[model samples]
Target: MRDQEPAPVERATRRLSTKETAELLGVKPETVYAYVSRGQLSSRRGQGGRGSTFDAAEVEALARRNRRESTPGSSPDELSVRTRITLIDEDRYYFRGVDATQLAARHTYEEVAEWLWTGTLRPGARFTAPKESLAAARRAVSALPEHSSPVDRLRVAAVAAATADPLRYDLSEQSVLGAARALIPTLATAPPLLRATYTDGAPIARRLWGRLSHKEPDEASLRVLDMALALLVDHDLAASTLAVRVASSARAHTYAAVSAGLGVLEGPLHGAASGLAHRMLVDVLDRGSAGLVVADELRAGRRVPGLGHRLYKGEDPRAQALFAALEELPAAHAALAAARDVVATTARHTDLHANVDLALAVLTTSHGMPAEAGETIFAVARTAGWIAHALEEYGERPLRMRPTGHYVGVRPPQPLPTQTGRE
Candidate 1:
């Protein structure tokens, strides 16, 4: 017989480097590692066992899964909104293309707010509440029950302030800007002050400090609070931000748009996380260990608050920035230690990281503020973001945010049930 054909040689599967895998998945290399740690994908040592490599086919399959999960029914281009204000990519975020943490480090909250609103950093920018609006907001907030949450008080204040402004219906950029400037300060000063030393014309953070705590604030503490506000000024299209945009798409005035956002913020998953974190920290401090507290939270089927965020695969950038600031304050040492302990204790079970809520809890607990103080700070700080979203939405087509309903319930034409006659 003619020379037997050589048996076909088996070929090894193709492998991809980490950089290639990340590019294929449309994420950063860190995110690729995060996926591996989470068990969503698998990796093997490359030739000579030098670097991890992913199966090429496996990476493509994961890319498909991610696309399916992130955009379920609609295409990304259709469901997404174009925005020039904030961009969250990888684990870091930006405000107007500038690093948000850097902005918070270099500028006051007012200056950052001005930059977000107009794309220009106005040094020494100041926002003053209109006296009439402030008085009306305070009156409305005072009428609520004593047990009303800070967000409740804020919603009432927004409505009251709206009534005081006769030109709220005017959607002109200048008019909206005017309303935004007046409304933010009005909201900041509307809550009942805990101390009698409240001073007008101070920065928003300074004014807010008197409302949240009675203790005298040191300059370092004040710096932390100011930076917190600046850092929290906006987070791109959060649940509350979406509400504000939807309301604005319907032509709601600035105050109403903000009120719509506040309504959504009161949910436990959104704005109340810091308060839960505050309570958890208190529990950890009292029990003298994070292990027991973490176990109890898991046993109760509740997620450990302030631990992880949906948008971040690594430590929250906001938390990182705030933690660095918190390190300088002597008073924050105990709470800061507790937060770290909590993170370490939880890491054994999950790959989660500390989020902004944990940092806020450290601040509030260390400064003698009540649990609800974080919610107040969030509501006040996010109002600026709500206004900015409202301004952008105003320029879009009216009712552009309205989504078509997908009826998954019983199909439309069921026979009407005849009412039974009572004997």
Candidate 2:
């Protein structure tokens, strides 16, 4: 809703960190960056070795302008009213007003992805021929190097499979989303790890061309992965979103936009932490107890990864959905069970609560999924959101991003034609 009048403007009192500026906009850093791209805000570059920060007052003013445009009585701005795809934000992300935790409880991965992509809750809306899709995905998996990480193989297969999508270029939101739903699962579940290869020396069969990969994935495991992917499908304006928007602003095609987002996702801030957390759980399990090991880590002042979120002071809502999914799995490793016990043991402070990352760690390990696959799964799932945000950004009016207070060095006069010896 529009603000009838500006709130009393406060004087520029302090420098705000990028994270703080992001909070002020009620959006993620990615969204604030969009504002920066539009010349709506100015960032200050400090002269010292420290990094740049923003003027709180300037950002507040920009935020105020946005608030005014959204005022209840005022007509919607053209940019806000654009009919492009909504990648990161959905309608409350609550299908039929039911939270995802409840939905994941009863539904399968196919059901959830369909619901997310189509906004339908019925099972019929899911893959009509899931068996065929599975077969094709399995065939694609062989294309990857067996000795290499299964996760890498999975990601490459997804990209390769997505290449067949002729309709990806269609600017229509419905068509693109339809493609995304079809692709997400085929990409999300990696082919069962080669049994003989791991147990004893063996070889792979000839690559099947679009042959269905009907290895009969552990249903519970897939459901957990699916739920995690769905919950994380979109978050408003993350770094990946910024990369997608920047690409789209250049009028790049949908695939290019998604590719840009995936590149950004490869970085630690956006996606790698999930696997690292899972690895930590493994380490504790390997040590036989979380007590001395965890204490030693804490003693060294080492902050563990994937414990919480930068934005969510409270428990991540997505985590609850993942935790529920993990519970439904019929078989979980002994190690996971031990980790759960340790987590409960320190409920007061360390229990702090698992985010989507920790939940995913629990889900994959319990289901016997490869450790390497976690980050890749995140990349595949979030690709849909990236494309959506990219399209939304393309329609926005052009704005220049200007950085200020960019000082180079102390002011020193240019040495007047220095004649070293004579002068």
Candidate 3:
């Protein structure tokens, strides 16, 4: 064969400055550095090796990926409510402009709740359940079926507590704050405790610990629980929070609005995720390997619970915080190891990261808490956020959340169908 001519050399690809890369990606220069740190984009020393530079092609591709991931395939008119509570940006979230994880690390759940309710963080803030409201809630929750989920019991308790408070209809900020403080503790103490110990004047987490676990909690475990509650107090307008907002837009009282949120939280995709994760962890521990349990789940056509979150691209921040806290407890070592194993085994098939649900599972499983304990914790913790959102919605025009139906059905012109009672 004839000798082939050497191919012409191609030009080197362009390298962009950090500012250019940030502009292309529609993010800040700091975010560009974050992307580099996360390995999403690579950077090289600039011309004289003074600054970093990124490949134009890689930056463009990353920008395209970001656009695709961010813009949802929903109508432009999709519900958008204005609020000044939580703000979720990329992997991190903030509460009233303060880092939520930092707050969780340093403050009690009550203080964080107070901060969310009012701009002021009250040191040593304690929420006390009124005797009448607590008694009513306990009676109503006790009347539920023995197998009722914690959320179900909570919903009942909210309604009963509402009935007990003659001022439930008061939507004034001060009145709502009072109701919120009272209602949170009432819900925390409503469920039947595993032990008969009274934690009347203790922090909400301490009161809730006795209800969720028979084992006495060490300080580390109690601290973890308190942090978990604080971290979970708010997360933008979640489905349940939106529900609470809608109820509040119609002028629902604090307890009623909170009940609306609790109702939505009972769905499998929401508050029930941790319970499922707990069960999965138990199965993994019993099977002696996460690989086997993960395989069974995939074989059953199920996505592994407690992995990945829509709002986070990396590991859930809440999960990171909880896992770090969990490491401090010697008792949580085994369950935490199992959770890590689950993450490692699943990574072979997909790139999902562990979310807060998995961390919650580790806590509940290691501490002898029931699978539903996570749900109870979520319900009690998120009640604070729900109250904040409800308070915000109360200030807006009534029924402002009502959306005009698009009328995609039979345009209201079809004749009434004949009665076909007996087929």
Candidate 4:
């Protein structure tokens, strides 16, 4: 009755610019361009040829494809060990089937150290010199420009070592493992930059990791360091690992791969927390009162830097292990001890646990090592895991992470202006 068949209401699918398309899809404009480059999207030019536009339907389909591709496996809650590393969402570190915290507490760091570098690296084995190829590595590091940060120093050293030894091209398992361990300490104490005014770097204290035996460093401190490394070693598909894997995908050598990982660590969000943790401890020590320190941090609207973890629901086992370990340190800072007590008592939850950061701060405070040492300590320890992971990635069939986009552009072309409508 109301206009019989009802007048057909024509609907025109709208077009969007690249920027608008990116916003709609929650991605960067460049990513959209990448999708276009890969032929995953389709676009057409306006009749006047101002700009190309894409069909909204095609764009939606591409977005759907991306969602399907990114969905996790069937058992999302279950953990999967990918490559050499095993991830339980965001809270564990494993080195070649070994639990990091267990090794850190039960065995010397050296044993854990050797295991990462070489899957076969284990404790109670006689140390063997591998031709001092790493010796040349020392000379390579000292030659970088003086302005390099610890990260750059590590990168430059890798490049230098890469140049000095022709043997790096060999990706044999034996060789990769050896490189992982040896380069660790080297990266920690690289040769001073050739051009800068800097103090001499520490020699790779070959026995330091060993000194963390149940005998010295107050078993408590070593425990803290161990837990810290275990927790810090890796995270699931973090920006850093993503960077490392990206490089690995190109079949870049291990050094380049590790170097790529370091690049991500150089960022403030990733590697700077160790520094922040160290400073927080220094503040507490300087204030000379742990209670005052916690109160001060709380008043300032700053949560204690090392007290909680993102994944552990406020009860980090590594932190628990470290707290137990801290009880055994030689002259551990009284303030840190007090702060730990304060945090346990006053925080929103009595359950707010100390994380690897606080644990590492305790270690550095007790050891009297340099303040920026945790980041380096972590970098060295994790190198083994990264290599192991890299090897695993290298062995897998390449997925070739190609970028794609949703095609969104201007309007369809308009006919050229006819003279007077063909008067």
Model 4 residue 78 CA deviation in Å: 15
lDDT of 1 by residue, 1-423 (tens): 799999999998899999998788765576677678757789999889898999999888877664441255677545566677999999999999999999999999999988888888888888887889999999899999999999989999999999999999988778999999999888888778887545777888888898999899988999999999999999998999999998998989999999999999999999989999999999999999999999999999999999988899999999999999999999999999999999999998799999999999999999999999999999999998888888877754456676667778998689999899989
Model 2: worst 10 consecutive residues (lDDT sum):
201-210
For residues 1-423, write the lDDT of model 3, one tens digit per residue. Answer: 999999999999899999998778765576677678657899999877798999999998876665431236656676666578999998999999999999999999999999998889899999997899998998899899898889889999999999999998878788999999999999998788896544678899999998999998878899999999999999998999999998997888999999999999999899999999999999988988999899899899998999999999899999999999999999999999999999999898789999999999999999999999999999999999999998777754456667667767767678988887776
TM-score of each: 0.82, 0.59, 0.82, 0.64
Error of 1 at 378 (Å): 0.6
Question: Whole-model lDDT for model 4 versus the true structure?
Answer: 0.60
Task: State the lDDT of candidate 4 residue by residue for 1-423, as single tens digits.
Answer: 555787779998887777666665555565566568658777777669876677777877776654442446645443233444554434555555666667666664555555554555464432322335456666765566766566776677666666655666666556666566556555644634222221223222333333222234444444456455545555445566777777765767888888888888877566656666677777777776567767777799977677676677755666666666666655665735754755655565556777766766677666665556666666765665667667655543244433455568865697786677553
RMSD of 3: 15.2
Query: What overall lDDT goes with each candidate model?
Result: 0.89, 0.56, 0.89, 0.60
Residues 109-144, candidate 2: write the lDDT tens digits: 445555554455556344321445546666777666
lDDT of 3: 0.89
On TM-score, who's better, 3 or 4? 3
CA lDDT for candidate 1: 0.89
TM-score of 3: 0.82
Off by over 4 Å in 4: 1-81, 89-98, 113-121, 125-136, 143-148, 191-236, 290-303, 333-335, 349-351, 403-423
Distance from true location, Cα of 261 in model 4, Å: 0.9
Model 3 weakest lDDT span, ten residues long: 65-74
